[model samples]
Target: MKKETGRPTQLITRKFAKELHSNFMKYRASIIAKYIKKEDANAVWFSVEELENYIHYIKSKGEKTGYDVNGIRIYFGVYPEQRKYAEKAGLMTVFLQATGKKIRKAAKEGEVQTLALVMDNGDGDISSIEPMNYGSIGRPPSLLY
Candidate 1:
């Protein structure tokens, strides 16, 4: 229970660890929701770089499981500021709607699936390029497919 530095793990039980994990998850959800809402209000398109920066900012707050590039891209829509930059950089930009209790509830209920829709604006025409499923949060039966 004691560490090399003399800290005691006994001071923190499994229950504490579990509670901490839950709290952290809640905090992460809140942060993601805040940023998403801000983006929605501004009507600003975010590139992958911007997303990464956002992730980094979150991590700086001592949050674990900070946004993984691949993981995040699975649920947000890509809207690269400069299509050429996205192509040259080999990354997709995206637009993320604010994550709300409603969406979270749907995700948990299996009534809806969170998807990352990638758009390609070629010749000034916006079109769906790809869509990726991130994960389901709700009921087991509803999450199928």
Candidate 2:
């Protein structure tokens, strides 16, 4: 089989594309279902600005989608510095690859982190505040400690 450099020829890439599409569909459906089941009509999952900022931030760092988990597509290579900004914007569950392997905050390798909101801090500035890890189910003290 001859391999094409620019375009994918009859190879495993086709199967992988199909798999990604299927997974995306499932994720979309789950999100819709969750929203529908919610009692509050004004309930917000994520705002447009937040999502746009997240995508922009992720792209700015040259990080790509690592994988999809629970309807959220995880992107990898988000450094500790970038993680704070992403988390402040409400992006969590970062992964190292599309295989769904997670990454931890401030980890050297194979670390996993789940970002959460700390508080409004009454400054009306989410960016002004730094994200803190009080600890969670799957997290351990970062090497910084």
Cα misplacement distance, residue 87 of candidate 2 (Å):
7.6
Off by over 4 Å in 2: 1-11, 32-88, 97-145
lDDT string for model 2 (1-145, tens) is 9856685464667678767656644664346446644211111134566555554543433223321121223332222435554332222223311122222224234545645322211212122112222112122211110
How high is the lDDT of residue 143 in model 2?
14
Assess every candidate by TM-score.
Answer: 0.19, 0.19
TM-score of 1: 0.19
Q: Which residue segments of model 1 deviate by more than 4 Å?
A: 1-10, 33-145
Model 2 residue 104 distance off true place after TM-score fit, in angstroms: 27
- Residue-level lDDT tens digits of model 1 in 4-117: 676755687778776775664466434644664422111123457766665554333322222212222323343344666432222223333211111111243444675443
Please give the lDDT score at residue 68 for candidate 2. 18
| Clashing residue pairs found in predicted model 1 | 77-94, 78-93, 78-94, 79-93, 79-94, 107-138, 108-137, 108-138, 108-139, 109-138
Question: RMSD (Cα, Å) of candidate 2?
Answer: 19.6
